[model samples]
Target: MISAQLPILQVLLPLLAAPLCAILRGRALPHALSVGTVLLSLLVTVGLLIRVESTGTISYAIGGWPPPIGIEYRVDQLSVIVLLIIQGVAAAVLVGGGASIVREIEATRAPLFYALFLLNLTGLTGMVLTGDLFNLFVFLEISSLSTYVLVALGTDRRALLAAYQYLVIGTVGATFYVIGVGLLYMMTGTLNMADLADRVAGVEESTTIRTAFAFMIIGIGVKLGMMPVHFWLPNAYARAPSVVSAFLAATSTKVAVYIMLRVVFEIFGVPMFLATHLSEIIIGLGILAMVVASVTAIFQDDVKRLLAYSSLAQIGYILFAFGLATEPGVTASVLHLFNHGLMKGALFLALAAVALRAGRTRRTDLDGLGQAMPLTMLGFTLAGLSLIGVPGTVGFISKWYLLEAAFDRDGFIIAAIILGSSLLAILYVWPLVERAYFRKRDPALPPVEEAPLPMLIGIWLLVGANLLFGVWPDLATGLAERSALLLLGGAR
Candidate 1:
């Protein structure tokens, strides 16, 4: 029975716990409930992943209704991998964020905050698990709405403005997505993804289908922070509560990428997508994002803002890989998705520790932090190296696959661009390293200490993951290879 209900339980557990969190009276209770809920979901996701690996895809229909009519929850190689990342990161953030939240958020609002956090988790998990296009939009809104509130919960007044900006842009993106879904539904008379995939193949040459594809990509691109549509990300991350920043940085955009992958390969069919100029256009925009966003990150004064821009650049790398449309290319993209989550989650959690002790994460404020908060800064450094794609880091593994994919395509220029982009990451990361290690401490500032043990544990958990996955990448690489094969095979 437990094995049979894993799909619904993965989503329902969090959905039920969220309301319980809201009704809970105290900070500790809500925090425990939220963390427990996320951890439980994580365990379920692990079970689902193992089951999928051993037994193939698991599909559970709602109300015993069949496909093309009743809603379905499907677990496959791709969905399970994404589910593990999402829940794993959420659990870590909640655990590590406890002390920081006490300092940054009002005590009275803590329950509400945790409630919203769980709701966000529910939406993200549902978005990946559901096999219906309309249900995807519903889950997307649930997540997006909760995220907007959580972003606004920060102490900074600017958080409100940041949340507002994200709300406007996010709504527009969702609207565009639904319009596309509506178009597809009208053309095919069904919203089930598998059914749509079958139906869409027959209308591959229709102008309506092509137009729907355009709308869907642009819509999802905004959510994924694709360059030119990424203006809302920097401020949102920089201003939101640190935990919220870490959670969003780690999981949200990756879900958008998963949706894009589903739409591209499962619904639209890769052959049709690649046949037009769309692939080239996506690749060009991705390259532009890699170069332009990295350059922009180098000049940012706020550390969170800098990391936010860096994320935009990293998204470019994933898009660049996906644009290649080959087995190796998709593998690199999927691998990077998991690796980036580890790197960014550690970085943001470390920064949260910094904010708790050092007040702010501006470059100037972080000067000489290596002496006062060595462990936190050390974790930051390790994650930074991963960002730079240094040897023995998870970042290197992804870049290695990406470079191989580029070479496989015989695109020497694209490979050069990949190498050049890593240099830009070093350029931006080095100044922070120097400030932490070499700059003199200000005598007037209060004496500071390392982050609390709980926070340090969270930071190092991900830091250790970075090193473990980096040194022995077979786990991530093998899973990615299987996922890529599944996607490519399905596309045909």
Candidate 2:
């Protein structure tokens, strides 16, 4: 039955569509195929989430082979929620991304571009679905490779350099990750996550295991763009085509965070993670990222770069909450993960609209855009408010849960720091409004109307979710609570 096959079908839909996209003859067909693929994948993902809620975790083995021997695809409360985030964002960006894509990417390369996007989706989804650590590495590379190519496809010449930088660093990260996986396999003799979880208990004290743990964290942290290792993100987002910027910003690092969660809590066990005081180090890094990245963002002239740096600060929030690992803390972390995706997706898609009409995305380039493109700028403003954690927005809801978690732990300084860091968001966020609404339009700039309808739909869809979840957050909160419990229970 279709219900029983949801796990594989969720992955296979995008996987099959990717190759078809590469060979498609024309722009419309490939774009439609990409949109349809992601839409179908989203539905499958939704079904998978519902089934998991009703029946608990679902594990599907490949080739009728049992888990620990055959490759397995597992869906649980945590993975299913993450799957929803991935497919949901992917669908929104693709369905509404056509105008931006046509503007930036050459018509000749359209099919391949769609191909890479679907491949990227396949890999990210697979990374969430797979039950083997080594399999995760494989999926990680698939997504990373596709992402590097997609970054290179930007109309801006700097995009190639940005892609190269990410390639060099991403390759290093992947190497570190694979080495860690190899060490884990050597010690436990199994790559299956469930089996390794059982086997790792006996060897938790081994020096090799400890070293492997460190390697994994460093590797995943680089992919996560956590503070010092984030050299590639700003330029990459700044130079890449607006749609690529939107998609990767919204989904890529979020998936890496999910992978980190699975490895840290489910595979390695939280007690071991906490015993090393790595949790403290993580919280410290989060705090530093919050203050430092927000400050750095305030200086950026390019809109995408500004948001990219802001993303690091947001990542810091997620990291800080994750390190707390209490039910409330983890709940906040999970909620913020999804909420942040909506925020970034809306912002970047709006950037695409800016580039389409204004010829660029610099702060100065946006003068009088509020009048020329009222809908797009207003949507951007709403998403920016979410980023700043304004009341009645998803961003505010995330911060509310985060503050509650910090108070539960009696960490007033952490709570103060969280609130103070959001104030920094205002510094960067306000200028966008100021430039759009207050300044006179430059005489030389061409007269322009609103962005194409498809693109506007994409931008506003995410903005609507920002408000919808902000005002009615029961669904996101319920999922986050279940995922938080699953993570905490798995750690124990």
Candidate 3:
């Protein structure tokens, strides 16, 4: 019975566990429940991916009602790939976060934290799986609301401020998305994405449809932490708990990028998006974000904040790929989306270990950390190499494809921008390497030890995956190629 309902079960398992977590009192139970629930969801996701790969897309109608009216849960190669990333990251973070959560959150609030984490996971999974735009908005809010609370649960007082700022910014983005949806519904009289795609083609020349496109793009851009509107991200990631930072850094913006890809190439179609000169605008912004954000990361004193900026820069790379509006371009974007998730998840989890030992992640705090926490710092270095696009790292595979895409279009300048921005990554990452290895420890400080075994397990899992995928990228590239073809094929 559950096998027949895998699409809904994948999301429902986490959603159901969230409230149970809230009602439960014991910290251990809630943590265990949360981890168990996500692991279950991950198993379901794997099943779904296998099923989809063998049988093609899966569509489940809520309440036995058909689509174009009732809500639909859809699973395709594109969404299943994202589902794996979201669930994989969430499960790993929860498993590794036990020790850190004990130190970082109050005992009484711990269950609620786990509850919120599961809820956030539910929302993200729903957003990717849902086939209806209005349902997508509903899930988006579920995830956003949960994210706000999770951010506010941080030990730092500044967390409250960061959550409030994100609430304001995120609400505006959501509102913009809904308004766009309303316009599309107004024009097509349908909320189903597949139906809308069919209906949208007829109205492509309509000013209303064009306006809707603009609203949706900007809304997703805000969520994607695109340049200029990305102010909320650094503080949110910097001040949130380490687990929250790792999860959001890896999953949230990447989901937004997925929505953007769906809307632009799947719904709006590449020709329509390019017709408005939006592609050119996006390409320019992508370059600006890559250079500007990477340069800013170089100057940040806080290690998390630096990575936060680095995330923004990575988003720029994905955006640049999308702006190319070609099949290989989309393939590069999708590949980077997965690769960046692996790289950033490993980096942040490693930093979480450092925070567990040092109690903070400022640059000065990490000084001479190499000797004190050699394993943790080594994991950080391995992931950092990926961030710098070193060969035999996942980051290199993505950037190489990106460079090829740029060169294919006779965009030598774009290729140079990609190379130059990577150099900026070195500028920011080198300081950490130097501080951790080259600098001497402040003898006045107490001795620090390596991260707990569970934490080390989580960090190394991601780092190992990065290296493994870097050397053998066929799996990621194959899925990405399929996704790009599906999007460009207009199969929704």
Candidate 4:
């Protein structure tokens, strides 16, 4: 009986624990609750994944009611991978990122930080699991609102402005999504995603439905930090406390991408993708994001900002894969979803350790400190290599899939562009290597040692995953393939 409730329990646990963390209102208690909640959530996801694989999609209704009337939580191939990434990142970052969080956030506010962090996780998990369109927006707000506070918890004064900027932008994005949902509700008289999917086909040809689709996509795009609308991300990531940046960068946009997949492929359906003339637009934007964001990253002096821009570029590749709307393309997008999470989690967590030792993460701050912080720098290096799509790394697995999709979709030209854009990763990534290992230390700062053991273990967990999955990618690949087929099936 309890097994049937995993779908709701996965989200409910974090949702309930968040307020308890706030109520307890102390460092140790809140931290323990946050860590315990995340670890429990991760275990729940694993169990759900096992059940979904053996039995197909699992849908649980709330209050003893059925779907289209009661709120529903759905777990399937598409959602499980992302839920795993979210909770896994949270467990790793929360358990190990404690030192960095304490260093950056005031001791007084640390309890609140843990509380907000749990709420953020709750929102992200709810967003992935909910089958109600309206509830998804609620979760989006829950997550976004929590994130705004988390970002502002940074020691820097600029964190306030960054959080404000994101808050304003994020609200606008949410409003746009709600407007779309309202239109759908009016048309179908239902807020359930499965119900809407069934009823939408009759009215999708209408102008109002088309407008709703466009609005929802743009709204989700803003949240995902899609190109041209992504000005808020770099500063937000740069100014947030180190652990917050690591968690948000690794989890937030990746989940938004999945929401896009669910919305565009499953809800709007693929016929609409091509029929509405949005496919080329999505593909073009992806191309622009890859080229433009990568170029922008090469000029960033702040290591966190550099990684932020790199993330935008990574989102482009995922979008491009999805724009193709083919089995291979969808598969590539899902694969990148899992793989990019591993590498970015590793990179950002390593940056957390870097900031702890060096005081700042500017290009200058890392100079010759590689010798001082070998394990931290080493993790950063491995993650960076994966970003560059180097062989025997998870980054390579993502690129290889993207290349395959490109080759199928447009032949040599798009494939060439994919390869060329990957070269841009090298340009941004190499500078850190040059500064960290090549230059001598400035001799002004005091001697420093490697990152804390917990931090190093967390970073290596992700880094090890990058290599293990790269070498033996069958598990991730298998799941991606199945998820993609289901996604493409709806579109077809």
Candidate 5:
């Protein structure tokens, strides 16, 4: 018998292990459990993905009850793709972060770090796997609450303030999401996402449903770090411990974007809204994010904040593709989702290594780093180049597809915006490369050594993956295309 328990075990292993991490109280023990739990989850994710692909969609009726009556855990194409990215990237980050985390966070707090990290993992996995909307919100809260605590764990005093600010903003976002879910429940009398999709289709013109949709978008927008709603992100990324920044950058916002896609394309009945102006709203916001955030990123002095702003801009590209609401557009968005996770994860780990070796990450502080820590900075440069959409890198593939989609819609102006933003990315990234390589060495600072073996191995894993995906875009794009169709209410 196929274990109906696998899905629950997938989540519970990490969820239940979190407290044990704290109890084991041994520094090495927690790290071992964290890595082991994530690896096991990755295996589970792979099994689920293959099972869904081969057997068609599988919905495990929680407690053996049917949907709209009992909770269901549905493994669909879209969810499977997200599940793979979350668990896969998580496993990679934990491998890369072993040494970096120990250096950056206090040893006494190591167990707590692993505990919170596991809780966050549980929340993200739960958010993706559940078929119920209210359950999504509950998982969202679990992720956000754990994230706020993780951010606070930084050694920097400012980490506390950053976490507090994120707490206020994140709380407000979660409250809005709950209100939206409440409204959705009021409209359909059912909280199951699939059931709600069926019901919302019949009431396509209802004002209540539309309002609920709007609230949910705004709520998820904050979490996704969508523009104007994204004020909390830069500081949180900049001030949090390096490992936290890397993990959150790789998975958190990407999962939030998955929620938005599910709501817009799956739950909302895509055919009903395809003719509406909602795409224009998304396009407008995305354009604003691309132009404004990229411009802002170009001017940051701190490397971490610069990457944070760049992340906001990258998200704009993903959303822009989604806003186009075409197969090509959605496919590009999904491809970029995976690509950006790799790029940002590698970049942040490199940054952690720099901060560990040099005691700072200010752009000026990075002067002559190429000479001192050639391998580390080379990894950073490669990831940065990918971010610039250089050929033979994952970033280039995403930009090529996004621009292609824009052209398909005869959106020359938007195409120009996309290209213009790529140039802005160049402006931000090139300066760091120049400073690291061309500028003279600072005499007061000693020669930098390579990042520890664990850090190098971790960073290389992501770097190699980034290049492999770039060369063979078909791997991700094919999966994304299939997932995109499933998201569009099973549209063929």
Candidate 6:
């Protein structure tokens, strides 16, 4: 018999350990405990994924009550994929953070920093695992509040401003989400996602339900860093501590995309909404985001900001897949969600290492860096290759699927737009690669070694993962099929 307790244990192990890390009150103790807890959580997430894939959707009701009346934690292919992303990436970030965090944070406050990181991980894991919409909001806020504090811990005073800016915007997003939930509750009288899906389909004509959908989409779009609403990401990423940047890049916005997927495919049901041109609207905005953000990235001198813009453009591709509203498209979207997380996380962490060695992340700072820190720059190049959808990289797998999806629907214009966006990616990434390797600089400075071992190893693992998945695309593609089938209410 499959045990429902495992899901709760998966989330609670790290969550309950968070307070102990704070209470232990020392750098060594807390870091060790935090890493242990995250490792344990990762194991649990893997076990849960295996269980779900072998069996089917697993639902664990709180207090043994049924859903829609009592709270529930549901694990399906979609939830399992998200949980794996959160825990697996969190483990990697924590491993990498060991040295980077020590370098960046004050020794006295290291314990608190780790404690907050665990809290943020707990919140994100919870968000992915929960079946209730209201509970999703609770976890969303938990992650958001902790993230604000984490971003503010950067050495730059501008980090404080970035944190505050994110706070204002995050609060607004959360408030809109809450209002949307309230509207859904008023009409359907339930918040469980499965039950809500059934009810929402019946009431598609209800203005309140439609308004709820609109509110929730807009709220999540803001959080997901959708175009015209992504002002908070670049500064927040640029100013945050390196460890924070790595962690946020790996996990935060990915969770936001998860919430959007939940809202769109699970709750709204694509068939009901596709006729309304919701998919077309999402694709238009996505194309705009892809083109505009890539161009913006090309102009950025700050490496972090350049990457932040690149991240926005990457999100545009994922959004474009969603807009296609086909099984292949949705599958591509889900696959990219995982692929981009690994790619960007590796890229940003490499930047953190560059910052550590050179003390700056500007394009000029990276000049002649490929020779000074060959390993670090190699990692950066691999990640950049992934971003541009080079064959044998995870990025290529997603784009390939996206192209196939576009062609499936005779969407030549959309296919062209996708390819054009990739060309833009090359424009932004190539300059840095050029500056690092091909460009000449003064020959007098002492050659720097590669990033510290933990950072180097952690980044390489992700790069390796990117390539492994790229060369063998079935790992994510197969899971994406399961996720798509689940989201489409077993239509496959």
lDDT of 5 at 329: 90
CA lDDT, every model vs. true structure: 0.92, 0.91, 0.92, 0.90, 0.87, 0.87
Residue pairs in collision within model 3: none
Task: Return the lDDT, model 3, position 261.
Answer: 90
Clashes of 5: 0
Error of 4 at 218 (Å): 0.9
Q: Write the per-residue lDDT of candidate 6 for residues 380-414, one digit (tens) a residue.
A: 99999999999989988889998988898898998
Write one digit per residue (lDDT tens) for candidate 4, span 195-242: 788888889899889999989999999999989799999989999999
* TM-scores, one per candidate: 0.99, 0.99, 0.99, 0.98, 0.97, 0.97
lDDT of 2 by residue, 82-139 (tens): 8887888888888778988888888999999999999999999999999988889999
Off by over 4 Å in 6: 1-3, 440-447
Runs in model 2 lying further than 4 Å from the true structure: none
Separate clash counts for every candidate: 0, 0, 0, 0, 0, 0
RMSD of 1: 0.9
Quote the lDDT for 37 in model 2. 90
Give candidate 3 misplaced runs (Cα > 4 Å): none
Tens digits of per-residue lDDT for model 3, 162-275: 999999999999999999999998999999988888988888999999999999999988999999799999999999999899999999999999999998887889889789
lDDT value for model 1:
0.92
| Model 6, C-alpha of 12: deviation from truth (Å) | 0.6
Better of 4 and 5 by lDDT: 4
Q: Which of candidates 2 and 5 is the stronger one according to lDDT?
A: 2
User: What is the model-wide C-alpha lDDT for candidate 4?
Assistant: 0.90
